[model samples]
Target: MITLAEAREAYRGYAPTYDLLFGPLLQRARRRAIRAANDRPGQRVLEIGVGTGLSLPYYRPDVRLVGIDVSAEMLAKAEARARRCGLAERCQFQLMSAEAMAFADDSFDLVVALFVASTVQDLGRFGAEIGRVCRPQGRIMLVNHFSTPAGLSARLDRQLSRFAGSLGFEPYFPLDRFLAETGLRVTASAPAGLFGRLRLIEAGKG
Candidate 1:
């Protein structure tokens, strides 16, 4: 498993080229996750692993947004994005961990993580934390590349699994097991991104 410190170091190096490299590739998936949020005015949204704030502009300016990531370098870029998008007033960025957040119970109307589930050290703890912060009936959104039941995609996931540390995320994380272990229930799911390699998931606190 990738430790928090290792993840932080990996992202620190990645922060410089992250947008240029993954921005275009992952933009659609990010947009899908935001759209699935169905945000409304006055709702508080928490974005875990909000690297470089790529999704900041996608969210409505009326909704309050708090973005957290483990890498200070990434958060710095995200803060800059918030400023560039004139969303600094509506969005806040912090250096925080997904596995252990500081927020109180039911503090958020919605919680989102895009392309981040695979990077977390403990999926169960991360999911539980997400559930704890999200109010009952509130929504949780995740956009990620998960291991398919059995197919070429699954084979691809397996092939990439060995290079997780260098890639910054695990490629073969099991979606169903993650949800079941964390007490989260998926309300909706659909293919997202190129070749349907990613999934856009909507869930509620279970």
Candidate 2:
């Protein structure tokens, strides 16, 4: 496995081309994630690993948005997007790691993380931190790819994990089990593709 620092450095290089490469798919996923979040107006929202602010446009105008990512370069893109979307006043971006967030307990009503679990070096710690910062009964909306059961696709996914890692992608997670282990109660889950290539998980902190 690659070190977190190495992964961060690799992503810095990809920041420029990241949106161009996955922008469409990512936008679709973000829409799905936001719909699953069921966010109401005036809710406090926190998004982890908010690369390029792809989800910013979907957020309700009345909701206060806070975004954090480990990559400053990525955050810069997100900031620019927020500005372009005329959401600069409603949203705030910060440089922070998912494993150790610097926020008060029970700070947010809704926490979102899209396509982020696979890249985390410590899944357990990341989940725990998410739980820690979220208020009781706070919703957590996630869109991620994970290892599927046995099949040709699974084999291909495993093979691709190698290249993905080299490119700073963590594209597989046991999301259901991870949430359970982290004490999150999953309220709903749906596969984003016919082959279960991506999943949308909606849960609440217990």
Candidate 3:
């Protein structure tokens, strides 16, 4: 399991070059995630593990956006990006954990967690926190590069699992297991990234 400490340390190092390294390569998937949100005007949206806020500009200016991240260094960049993108008025950044968000029940209309499921220490807690903050019937979107079930890639991922802790993410987390652990009512899934290796899972809260 990837601990909060490990994730913070890993992202601290990635903060400076995060946009450069992940920006273009992951841009397509990021776009897919934002589009899937289908946010409306005046809606409150929560983005967990918002990273450098590369997806901030894509959100509608009319929507209220709150982005939370565990890493201070990354959040600083995200805040700076929000300012640069002129999103400061509609966007808010906070240093928060996905497992324990600082929000009231049913606080948001939508929650987006892109590339975050594999990084958290406990999927169940993360999912529970998400469900609690989201209004009943609210939407949740998660985009991640999940490993295949039975393939050469799956074996390679298992072998790499030993090193995943240090890397700050699990390489072998399955889609079905995530649903079971999170207890989310998934509605649809769309292909993202190259060869559909990245998945955008859309769900609803009860």
Candidate 4:
């Protein structure tokens, strides 16, 4: 039960060194996420929880991108990174909550969340919003860690649950449950990252 305020503060503290720390570790997953999207020129893409804009440089130059994060501190760094990487013209960074986005329905061709499912306070609402904003045939790309069906990873996630409230993520989040609740249809999924701990999921609105 990590409150939004606590999640904000946690990210504020992490903003400064986020790129140096989590950036390298999550880069592989991010790359995988964007490539799987297969975005086209002039398409609009929304990136939820686009921390520090690490994925900013990876998107093709022709696409239009909107990246939103709850933490202003993190968004500032993302803005700077976009400018530094010469992606400023193609990308926009804003401070907005994922669960309640301001955009209208059926507004984007693609939506993405990288390493974000664990951090969202209301995943159901977030999923609904993702579906609402994306066109019927649009894609929802996610690269995240989910509780393994069984084995060591599953056990470890359960053990980590005790610290979830303080850490701002619900460890042991079940994929089957999440998909069912969100009503998102998964068209593709593949193991990713170290020991296949992370997953790359491509889904469409049902």
Clashes (backbone N, CA, C under 3 Å), per candidate, total 0, 1, 0, 0
Off by over 4 Å in 2: 180-183
TM-score of each: 0.94, 0.91, 0.96, 0.94
**Cα RMSD (Å) between model 1 and the true structure?**
1.5
Winner on lDDT between 3 and 4 is 3
Of candidates 3 and 2, the better by lDDT: 3
- Residue pairs with colliding backbones in model 1 are none
Candidate 3 Cα misplacement greater than 4 A, ranges? none
Candidate 1: count of backbone clashes, pairs at least 3 residues apart or interchain:
0
Q: What is the per-residue lDDT of model 1 for residues 18-124, given as tens digits with 9 covering 90 to 100? A: 99999999998887678758457778999999999999878887878999999999999999999999989988888889899999999999999998888988888
60-147, model 4: which lDDT tens digit per residue?
8788889999999989988898899888898887889888999999999999988888887777787889989999888999988878
lDDT of residue 166 for candidate 2: 71
What would the TM-score be for candidate 3 when compared with the true structure? 0.96
Provide the lDDT at 162 for model 2. Answer: 74
Local distance difference test values of all predictions, in order: 0.86, 0.80, 0.89, 0.84
Q: What's the true lDDT of residue 200 in model 1?
A: 89
Candidate 1 TM-score, true structure as reference: 0.94
TM-score winner between candidates 2 and 3? 3
